[model samples]
Target: MTHRIAAFGAALLATTALTVTSLSAETLRWARAAEALTQDPHAQNEGPTTTLNHQIYEPLILRNMAGEMEPALATSWEPSADNPNVWVFQIREGVTFHGGETFDASDVVFSLNRAMSENSNFRELLSGVTEVRATGDYVVEIETEGPNPLLPNNLTNIFMMDEGWSVENGAEEVQDYAGGEDTFSARNSNGTGPYVLTSREADVETVLTLNENYWGIGEFPLDVTEIIFTPIQNPATRLAAFLTGEVDFIQDVPVQDLAQVEAADGIGLGTGPQNRNIFFGLNVGADNLERDNVDGANPFADVRVREAMMIAINREAIQQVVMRGQSDPTGAMLPPPVNGWTEELEQYPEFDLDRARALMEEAGYGDGFSIQLDCPNDRYVNDEAICQAAVGMFAQIGITVNLSALPRAQHFPLIANGETDFYMLGWGVPTYDSEYVFNFLYHTRNDGRGSWNGTNFSNAEMDEMIVSLSSETDLEARNATIAELWEMAEAEMIYLPIHHQVLNWGVSDAWSTLVDADDQVKFKYFELN
Candidate 1:
């Protein structure tokens, strides 16, 4: 199945190259299962939100379709020869914001500082930065705590914002996403990207028009002049929109209907591996869960109970049945391509219901307990169904799981605010490194890091290892620390590993676009025939 998709992709690439010369301007109607939670660039770091924001905002560094780092707003960057802790960046010249403000180093300084604020969800990505200074009109310098080589990789998604525009609109500070506070920046945007936001009706539709004065006008394939994006939560309605030509592109193609879409005329299918891992999180540090049957203590705090829950989940069965062979069962939190990944870390004990039962009995949970499982129905592929399957498996062990499925907008805040006892989440490492995972998921929750660590698990030794990876210049030493941290994470069962999702994009035959491993659809790369 993978080979067939690769061949089809190659053929599509060939067709795209042959048709580029004759491409024309057209309106691209795109649909997805969920809408971007907010338009504030620094509020949310989720995939769907970032995908929508990338069209209007420009980051200092950009990850191309092939997952390679490339220059975006910043033309060139390198460590300062005089000081190893300071990195110098040369901002692009003559770039104007959508509202006609000139791009400069001050905007860069303001944007980076804004993202490092307490309300910014992207603060974890910039935890190592000590300061950001504008040396000149177009020259900026970033000083880290120590010698950091992966700073540029971390900034791939930290979008730049115009300082003047934000101040004028009374949105100088980042939106408090977890607090549910709405700001002007959440609905209005003025960026220097290839597209300008013309109309934005949250959760309904968004309209964008090409930036005629974009810096990369001729460098990219910017053939689509207008974009009309709609969020259709119902899978049937989304598929119907695609089938009837109401929508030209669908980022998420239903796995069950892949065959039907492939066999249908004037529809093209592109499949690839996504750089994300879906997992289950438990509040292991809490003395007593806020929403569970346990009386005085949290059952998840017991390693035996965690182990029992881990084995109760049959990942192979979920892969084959629920995912329809569209997922790769994984044992590690990070995917194989990420740094610090090894075959030894990928091995998991085979599923055994009998062993799980014995462990539960040994942990004084033979009678089992009931707990609420929070899941997002529209976030990941078959997420609610996966949770439903786990509920049944857990029932065999005398555990009753009350499933609570909600939209991504409502479901994420529950985890972000540490309100849910158990929840489902999917993580993607944009930096392609284990340090990115450790910094956000394993580090202790604090002002500088662990914004997403809802599990409430913390270790002083593990925190030391995680912090050392940022400043350690030696490659072997850094990797060793990463391995040690993973060893602790696996032994403690910080998160129950599920599987890596597969990317399936459904597009009309009238257009061609690359399938990114991150599942980000950049319409700037789209070519219309």
Candidate 2:
């Protein structure tokens, strides 16, 4: 009996491996509910495309399972004793890009410089570094304008592109997600990741294969890999694909289908509370056609109007109707895990229609006003439904929100350029630090940098707090700064924190390894059981 059981277990292992290996000979077959809109990481900041880009490009540093920064292309880094602002990194030797060209300090320098150069989306994240220099063959040093300590985590998107491949392909600058002319980085990618992009069918399918010459650990146990991404606009159609086993994984699982999916056989449901906050941004700085025309100015500018809008939002209705009880009404941008930052911060004023109407009246809008609410149709979980629900809630207070739903590729640029009035956005903390929030969303503009502050929101005190928080080595002081920052944001009604989404992925039992970090899936760690 013992020998028979041993033979059976061996056969099972072989069977599982064969099941994965027989898919496409050179490509492992994987499916997701959505397709990537763009292959460029710098160009594609939306959620769906970010996942596909994960398999195609390799960031300078990748996060480990514990959410800690680990070496990828860069082996180690050190801060200068004389000045905390000066930092140096040692690049790994003998590493090569996917195109067979050797990797060096020049690639790192070029990538950083390009990301920080003129008219780039990533400028805000890389703004602290006053200078980035390639010191030696495998060495690079960074000089910050001030003591910037979030460098390690910020390097997550600092993906290294092949200088030779990019130049050879005539791809110099990254593509504009909006309606920009053309650029090389817009389409093709050259990286040191585990997979290579064989072909990308925008909004339809993207296929990748194992990079045999990858520098990191061996290709995940799966021999060849193929990522099939399809963006389904209808929720029922997407759920049907997963139900019928047409697709292995669905990208954004609908909340209403949780119970039904749990009851299904041969289908596995994985869920975790995502470290992302879905919220709304009001244009308090400028006026657009999609805004309230009555005031002829940004209504969000008045703290009273912003506070009223926040109160009018019935988060419970949003949770029950749209989320289907799969989300938590978060009080702040940074979730609870990152220490005392969110401890004392008060949640946005609860859904009080009367209070909201009263505030609106106080702001000289007794009859309320009409404004356009720009939202992404396929970006977040039930994103359109959430916006639709908001329409009803806001209407109760006599505020007519004209909803303009568009794809994220277009929606992001429209809002980024300050063209939208009121918009819905889902933000994930890139650095896993509260300080990341202060820098990207709050800090006053020193130059043309600082992302997502399209509201042109500025506070000199907040800027000083962020600078002090960045360089302060003491954990307690840094956390205090974060707490103070949240308090100020709350007092000022910076951005409305809606709810923290619960991430759900529908998969088959055949796939064993699954790591859902902040809902950003990296395929390198995925392996066949």
Candidate 3:
């Protein structure tokens, strides 16, 4: 009764032959159970969108699932001895873009500068980045405000663009691809990674081919001439497609389908620890709100009220029932394995309705208060169900939660704009560090730039600690700073961290080099054996 596929190739041939026969040469077809709003890497937050861009665009530095930094576009980097605020990087050589443009200092400079520019959603992502300069054709130097230690981690998301292609196409604007058609970088790729983008059908499917020009790694040892990605919205439909051999891999296997996937033969289920932490963020800055008949007031402005809501919700029940034993309930905002920064903090606390009631009564909410909650139906495992469970739990303690579950495309902008009083979100650590989660989600102010502090969770002490951790090069001192940040977040309940769900990447057994790193599945690293 094992769910392992036997003679998987023959099975795939039987199911995919119908449509794959018509697929162009060197094409690999994959599937997503949802849709993406744009092809731009900097603008989107969902997992599926990130996987697509990772194939075509190479970030300056790459990160592993354990949050360690590795070489990618940048070969090596070190801080300037004389200038604690400045860091220097040696760009990898002999690399060319898909359009035959060389990778060098100029591209690094342009990309970093663009990321920090105004109106670009990545601006906060480049915080404290004062200047980017090319000391040599293959060497780039970055100056920051302080002794920033997380620069390498931050470098993992500043994707390098072809200077020549961008300049010629007149797309130097910071947000040129925010919501536009596929550009040269989208449909084609000239990265130093293992794959190249060959074709893209917007939200439907995208095809990629192994990069023959990849300089770091020798030609990938598989014969996957092409990789095609497809987005299907229904869980049953996606599972049906996989069971029928119509697709080789599927992302985010639904909770209900886990047993079926494991029990079926000729199929395999891949699971690992993901960096994402699902939580609810409150708009503490919102001016218009009803809190215990107090007109135009925000209860979330008080730490006590925020903490009360955390105690009222039952994280354990969600983990056991709704999550179906697929999650880890947490007290800290950042998950474990994010370096030594995850401290031993107080638990999120058992769900004590009476204690919650007492706290609310003290905060002038004995009768509870009404607030709007924004949620995305297709973003996380049991996202809507989790929110609904929270709504029911809160109702038991007198909190009225109005739930609205919409698609991610529409939900992202609204939450980023602070249009929702509260919302459900799962953040994957792009840098694999606690600083990435703490600074981006809790410390930084939500200005709709690049930072994810959409809930306006701000504290001067936390902000100072984040800045210090960013510039501190000493590992011990940096860890100490990270601990301070986490402690503050726990004390303040900045974000109610649910369990770090196990990432399930169900794919064909023939796909090699398919390890789960950074909780992302890049088709470039995978090949049909």
Q: Go through the candidates in order and give each one's C-alpha lDDT.
A: 0.87, 0.69, 0.68
* Model 2 spans > 4 angstroms off: 1-34, 81-83, 219-224, 287-290, 445-448
* Local accuracy of candidate 3 as per-residue lDDT tens digits, 394-446: 88878888888997877776656656668888887665567667666876564
Q: How far is 176's C-alpha from truth in model 1 (Å)?
A: 0.3
| Top lDDT hit | 1
Residue-wise C-alpha lDDT for candidate 1, range 1-529, written one tens digit per residue: 2222321112212111111111224788889998998999999999999999999999999987767788999999999999998999999999999999999999999999999999999998888899999999999999999999888989999999999999999989999988999999998899999899999898898999999999998899988888899999888899999888888888888888888887877778777777889999999999999888888989999999899988989999998899998888878898766888888877776899899999999999999999999999999999999999999988988889999999989999998899998999999988988999999998999897888999999898888888878878899888888888888999999799898788878877777667777877778888776
279-322 in candidate 2: lDDT tens per residue? 88766655433456674565677888888878888888788777
TM-score of each: 0.96, 0.89, 0.87
Model 2 residue 27 CA deviation in Å: 5.2
RMSD of 3: 6.1
TM-score of 2: 0.89
Clashing pairs in 2: 28-224, 28-225, 28-226, 34-230, 171-184
Sort every candidate by TM-score, greatest first.
1, 2, 3
Clashing pairs in 1: none
As a whole number from 0 to 100, the lDDT of residue 423 in candidate 2 is: 86
